[model samples]
Target: MSDLTGSTDINTANLPIIDYSRIEAFFFEKTAENVAENAKLLRAVNDVGFIYLKNHGITDEKMKQLFDYAKEFFSWPVSEKEKIESCESKFFHGWFSPERTSKTRIADQKEAFDIGDDSNLVRPNQWPADWPEFRTEMNYFFEKCHEIHLVLLGTFAETQGLPKDHFDSFVNEKDHFFRLLHYPATTPDSIGDRLRASPHTDYGTLTLLFNDNSGGLQIRGKDGQWLEVPPIPGYAIINIGDLLSRWFNGSLKSTEHRVVEPPPEWSKLDVEGRLPPRYALAWFGNPNRNAWIEPLSSCITAESPQRFEGVWAGKHVADRIAKLHKDGKAPEVWKDSMYREERPQQQQQQQHAQLPALA
Candidate 1:
C-alpha cells in the first residue's frame, strides 16, 4: 500500500475532485484489474487526512437545493424552531436550537440538525411540514447520501488493500449520522479555549464531509500543529476515523481537529464584522450494533497481534462519548442526573465485589 501522508496546503482551490465515474472506476475494479496511480490516492489520505471529491455521483443541482433548504431551516425564528428542540429526544441527540451547544466542552458559536441513516430511528425530520418539497428533498438527500456512503466504503476497502467487498458484511446495517452545521457570525470574544471541536477522534470508521467554500476545518499534523483544510468545490472531504485508524495499525492517523471562526478580511466594512456562516454536512459511518470490530485478520500478523479487543460498534461509541461529556471533556451530548446518579452505586458494588474478606 502507498503512504497515507498528504500535502499540508491542500485547499478547495488546489484539491483534486473525484467524480462518480472516477469513484466507480477506482472502487469497483476487480482485484485483477490495475487501477490508476494508487500512490496518489494514498498520499491524499495520509498527508491531508482528507480529500475533496468532485464528479462524485451526487449532482450540483441537488447540492444547491439542499444548501438552500438548510439555510432556510436554520433561518427560522427561535420560537418556531424550538418546537422540535433537540433536548426533547431521549439522547440530547437531535435538532439543536441555535447557540444551544458548543464543542463537547468548549462553546462553539454554531447550531445544527442531526439525522441518522436508520430509517426506523430517522423520523421525517421536523420540516416545516407545510412545504411539500421539504420531506421530498430531505428523503432524497438521505437516500443519495446512503448510496454514496456504500460506494465510499468500497473505496476505503480498496485503499486498505482489501477486496472492495471487505466492508460489506459489517455495514449491512450501519448507523450513519448526518449533521448539518451552521457556524454563525463571530466576534473576537467568541473564540474560547482554543477549541472549535475539542481534540477528539471521531468514533466511527470513516466520515464524509460536505463543506462550503468558506473553510475553517483544521486537522492536527504529525508535528502537532493544526493545519486548515481548504474547502475544494465539487469535492466533499473524506477522512479516516478511529476504527479505520486502528485497522491500519497506526498507518493512518485519526488526527485531532477543531473549527474556528474566520477573522475579518479587508473586504469587511466594520471592525465587528463577521464572515458568512459556514455550512458543512458531516456523515459519520458505523457498522451494525452487533458487528464485531476486531482487527481485520489480513491487517495483522503474529508480530503485531491485535491492538484493540473486539467491540460492538453501537455501545462502544455511545460509552466513550458519554464518559467524555460527564468529565467535561466533549460537549456533543448533554448528561442527565439519572446517568450521574446511578454511577456511584454501580461502582461501589463492583468495588465491594472485588474486595477480599478477612479469613
Candidate 2:
C-alpha cells in the first residue's frame, strides 16, 4: 500500500518531480479560474505525499546565511555541542549531538544535530555566547520558518475547502520545531542501508524541508518504488504528515522517507577530498497545544468514515515526538507506532496494567 521499504541508492533523473511554478500556482492561483491547478497539487499530495517547491518566496540569501550558520555551529567541538544537548523535559525539541545512534539499518556512518519546540517552555536554546552572528542568524532562520509555517497551514486549510482561518483557531499555542541535520558519510555496513536518518513519517501537521544538492532524500511512490527527491535551489520539500492525513481523511499522504549513506561516487573521495555529507534544514509545523484536529465534513466519506477522531494537535504531536526522543537518539523508531507513543507513559502504563495480566 504505502511504501516504507526504505530504499538507499536512488536515481534522481527518473523520479516524479514537481518544480516551483506548479507549487506557486497551487498556492497563489484563484480557486474559480485555476481549479485544475489546485486539483493537480492535491492529487500529487494524495499520491506521492511529497513535492519539490520552487519560487516558494524564501530567499536564497536567507538560505545561505542559515546554511553558513548551521555549518559553523556543527563544526564546533563536541564539548561545545554538548552544552545544548536536549534536556529531559526538552526531549527532541532542542540541540542533539552526533553519532548518537548508528544509522538505522546500518553501522555508524552519519552524524547529525536536531532542534525542536520546547513544550515545557523551560529550555532556552544554548546560544554560542561568543558568536553573536551565529546566534542571530540561526534564530532568524528559525523565526522566518515559523512565520512561513503559518502561511503554509492556511494554504493547507484552503486546499481542503475550509476557511482560511480553519487551522488558526486550533493553533494559537504552537508546538512547532526547527532542526538542522548533518549526515556525514562513512564506511558502509552490512545491509548498506545505514541511514543518516531511518525511514519514518513525520508526526505533526506538515514538514517543510530545505535540502542541499547533496541529495539523499527519497519518498515512497505509488509504484512501490523509492523515488529520489532531488534538490531545488530556493525550494522547500513539502509533505503531509500522519496527523494531517487523518485530519484530511486521507486526502494527503504522509509518505515514508530516509537519509542513507551517500552513493559510491560521492563516497570515494579521500578523507580530505570527500564531498561533505548532506545538510538539511527541516521544520516540523505543529498546532497549538490545544488545537483540535478533525476531518472536515466535506472530506469525510462512508468508506473512510472517521478513521481518526478530533485530536488535540499540540498535545498529540508533542507527546509522540517526545516519546520518539526518549526511545533513542534518532527519530526513526518513533515513527513505527503513533498511538502507543502519542499517549503519555502514565496513561499507557495504567492502560497496560488494567489489561488482563494473566493472559
Candidate 3:
C-alpha cells in the first residue's frame, strides 16, 4: 500500500487496505492466508477505524450506474427535487437540499437523499415520481450493501471472540439507512470556509462509503492533524462508527472525518467557474430498533472499565439525527424515529391511518 505522505503533506497517514475476497474465504474456511487477512482487518479497524476494502462483491458497473443515477437526480431543478424534501417526512427520509441539513455554522455544501428499509412501517421512503428506475436501482444496491454489512458484522464478532452469528439477531429488523449524496461544483467565493461535509463521526455501527474518487475526504489522525483519505477506484471505504466504538468499549476507534472543498487542481472549472461536482453513496449499518448496545464483556477489563451505559440502538440514532435539525429535538413520541416515549392515542391512530405503502 502506498502512503499518502509527501514533503508538503507530512501529517497524512497511510490507511490499511483490506481484501474483501479474502474475508469471504475466511468466513467459510479459515486457512492461514485468510486468517492473516482477518487479522489485518481487525488491526486496521482497532487502530485507524477506516480502511479501503477492495474486491468487495459490488461490481464496478453497479457502482457506476448508481453514481450516474445520483448525477441525473441531482441535475433536476431545485423545485422538482424539493417535492420530496426530507422535512416533509417525520423520520427524516427523502431529499435534503444543500445548507438545509447542517448543524454547524459553516453549512455543508451538499444535498442528499436518505432511504431506509422498505419494510419500515413508520419510515416509508419518498421517491421522485418521475424516476422509477432510481428507486429500483437504489433498492437493489441497498440490499447488496446490507449483505456486505452482515458479513462484516460476523467478522467483527468472531474477531472479538464471540460467535460468528452473535450480531445476527440484532439486525433482524434491518434498521439501516442508505444515503445518496451530491456535492455541487464550487467556486472560491461561494465555498469560502465551507466544507462539502463538516467534521463529524457517524452515529451507527459501520459506514460503507462509495465515492467517484474526486478526493477531499479526510480523517483526523491520533496526532490531531487531518490526514487525506485518497479514494481508490473499485474500493469501498469502510469505517467504524460511534455505536460500534461503544460496543467495543472504545477498543475500536471511531475516528472523526470530513470532506473538505475539492482542491482546485483536482477538477477543471465549468463555464460557471465551478469545479466538477462530487457524488457518493453511504450505507449506514445499524442494528434493529430494540437492540441493546453496550460494551461487550470481552472488550472490558481492569484497564478499560465500561465507559458507556447501554442504550437502544434506535433511540441513540434518533437522538443524533434530531441534533442536526434546527429545533434540535425530535418528536417526543415519533415511533418511526424509534423514540421510546408513547404517543397520544389520537395522534397514533391518525398516523397509522395515513401510513404510506412501503417502497
CA deviation > 4 Å runs, candidate 1? 1-20, 27-34, 46-48, 88-93, 97-105, 121-128, 158-162, 192-195, 263-271, 302-305, 320-359
Q: What is candidate 1's lDDT per residue for 260-332, written digit by digit as tens?
A: 6533331142455545667887777767655556667666777866666554455555555455434434433
| lDDT, ranked from best to worst | 3, 2, 1
- Following a full C-alpha superposition, what root-mean-square deviation does model 1 have from the true structure? 7.3
lDDT for predicted candidate 3 compared with the true structure:
0.78
Question: What does candidate 3's lDDT look like per residue over 1-359, in tens digits?
Answer: 65342334334458888888899899788899999999999999989999989898889998999999899988989888878888634577888864555454555778889988877776789999977888999999888888888888889998777888899898877789899999888875666677677778888788999988677788988888888777778889999988888899988888888887555445567898877788999999988766678999988899999887776676677666755564322222223234334346534643444222111
The clash tally of candidate 1 reads: 21
Q: Pick the candidate with the highest TM-score.
A: 3
Q: Residue 139 of model 2: what lDDT? A: 62
Clashing pairs in 3: none
Give the local distance difference test score of model 2.
Answer: 0.61
Q: Show the lowest summed lDDT stretch of 10 residues, model 3.
A: 327-336
Better of 1 and 2 by lDDT: 2
Q: Where does candidate 2 have its weakest 10-residue lDDT segment?
A: 350-359
- Candidate 1 structure, TM-score to reference: 0.76
Among the numbered candidates, top lDDT falls to: 3
Candidate 1, run of 10 with poorest lDDT: 333-342
